[model samples]
Target: MTAVTLTADRRRGLQRRIRWIVTATIAYNVLEAVVAITAGSIASSGALIAFGLDSTIEVLSAAAVAWQFTRRDPERWEKPTLRVIAIAFFALAVYVIATSLLALIGRVEAEHSTLGIIVTAMSVVIMPFLSLAERRTGRELGSATAVADSKQTLICTCLSAAVLAGLLLNSLLGWWWADAVAGLVIAGFAVREGIEAWRGDACATSVGMILEGDDHGI
Candidate 1:
């Protein structure tokens, strides 16, 4: 095959792989959200509930990315899909902030959530690498949809870390308010990312974009 043909084939392969990975991640997140919410409700852990909501929003973002990827003309749909993803993130942030504030004002204490901590720890360990890999691959392929998906993964990594920290502090230090405080941090990050994504600015200058000669990669 010619070099052009080889590059096209490689791009197709990468797209397929990214689609599979994102789909799998979304599926797992859906299950995790359900489990986390159930456990959080029983344990009365606000952090766990916020983590579950974050995962649920991630599932929506992943689905949006998948739709963008499979479109016949992704460029035409990119901006709209990204806006929708951004709105989803914004909604999640609003929910987190409201709930966290209520918990803080009421002095509601989170109960022990061993399961929540374990799941969040697992996500913290796995998600950053997945996001970085996807970001690099998306940049190489000049795929905005994939880059957006990578941002969602990065958000997941951050949320997991915050959730884990909140759970740990609450569990070990008996700082009952730590979980709600962490929820506020997560909400702040989510709102920032949501605004960026809504403005079509996510991955504005990602490493992949620099390599691909596109400043507005996502």
Candidate 2:
């Protein structure tokens, strides 16, 4: 095959991989949200509930990217899709911060949650592999949306670790406050990712336009 054909084939492969990655992300997050929320309700654990809500936001973010890729001209849809992802991140930050503060002030002591530990532990193992796969493909494809989605997945991994730590600490040492602290950390990461996504949209949009114009001139 010619070099052009090889490049085209590689791009197709990348697109396929991205699709699979985001679809898996959506499926896992949906399952996670349902299970985490259910477990939290049963245990009266604020942290697990907040983690579940974050998983829901992850679903939205991944869905936006999935929709973007479905378009014939995905670049045209980039800005709005990125806005959706950014808004999801901001929503996550706001909720996590507010809930963490309430949990701290109310001296909320979360009951031990065996299910929470198991689910979060599974996420901790699963998410990093998904994020890394998507990240590598995104970089090769020069797809900011895909990269942003991967970052969101990475953050979910962080949250998994946080919730796991919280559950473990509370179970082992009766340190119910650990989860609240972890929630604050999650909030900070969410805000940072949101700002980065919004800023990246502007830069990537400009670059995409330039590349498209060049192709037209060719």
Candidate 3:
């Protein structure tokens, strides 16, 4: 009984930490979206605009995670939360692909965007830490929603790197098409992750038997 009590306490502590991390993610993404969209519009850079939209999707994913944990039965919220995240991912992919295709075919030129560069660089630095923390805690807690959210964060990190590289190449090498290419790569990644999240295979369900009744639903 004592061991069981201690284990439950630890789980509660971890869940609280995961909640805090998701909250921080949502806050940062909100700021990032505003800054990136503003800077992208100013620079007329499609890649930067897409990056900003990706931040919005990140906000949605994090919000879903937050909503799940706030429920009386967090496990019961898992399927819906995953569906929301998957939809966000698919939306991200569609937007990015469309933007990239337009930029590529139209021969659209992207101007140097120092602000976009700075914001994406910061995201690349910050998101990894958030992802690692949540992933570790979520796995320990047997919370698939938390782990899925962490994956979403990690995907954003990858998008950050792609967007940063594109901005740097355009600014330094005058490779205007680099941004479009990077957007395509980001689209591919988003699609893959979206499938995984939709399948609810973002993490194993071996712990806690939480997924035993997953298909039947509450």
Which is better, 2 or 3, measured by lDDT? 3
Ranking by lDDT: 3, 2, 1
Per-residue lDDT for 1-218 in model 3, tens only? 01122255565676688789999999999999999999999999888888898899999999999888877777777778988988988998899899989999998887888898999999999999999988877766677778888988998898889889888988899888886887788789889988988888877753354332222211
Name the lDDT of candidate 1.
Answer: 0.75
**TM-score of candidate 2 to 2 decimals:** 0.89
Model 1 lDDT tens row, 1-218: 11121255565666676777678778888888997898789898776887798788888888887777787665577678878878877887888788888888998788887788888888888778778877776666655666777887787787788778878887899877776777788778878878877777765443233244222232
User: Which sections of candidate 1 miss by over 4 Å?
Assistant: 1-6, 205-218
Give the winner by TM-score. Answer: 3
Which pairs in model 2 have colliding backbones? none
Poorly placed runs, candidate 2 (over 4 Å): 1-6, 201-218
User: TM-score of each candidate?
Assistant: 0.86, 0.89, 0.90
Q: What is the lDDT of every predicted structure here?
A: 0.75, 0.82, 0.83
lDDT for 37 (candidate 1) = 91
Please report the candidate that would top lDDT against the real structure: 3
- Candidates ranked by TM-score, best first? 3, 2, 1
RMSD after CA superposition, every candidate: 4.7, 5.3, 5.6
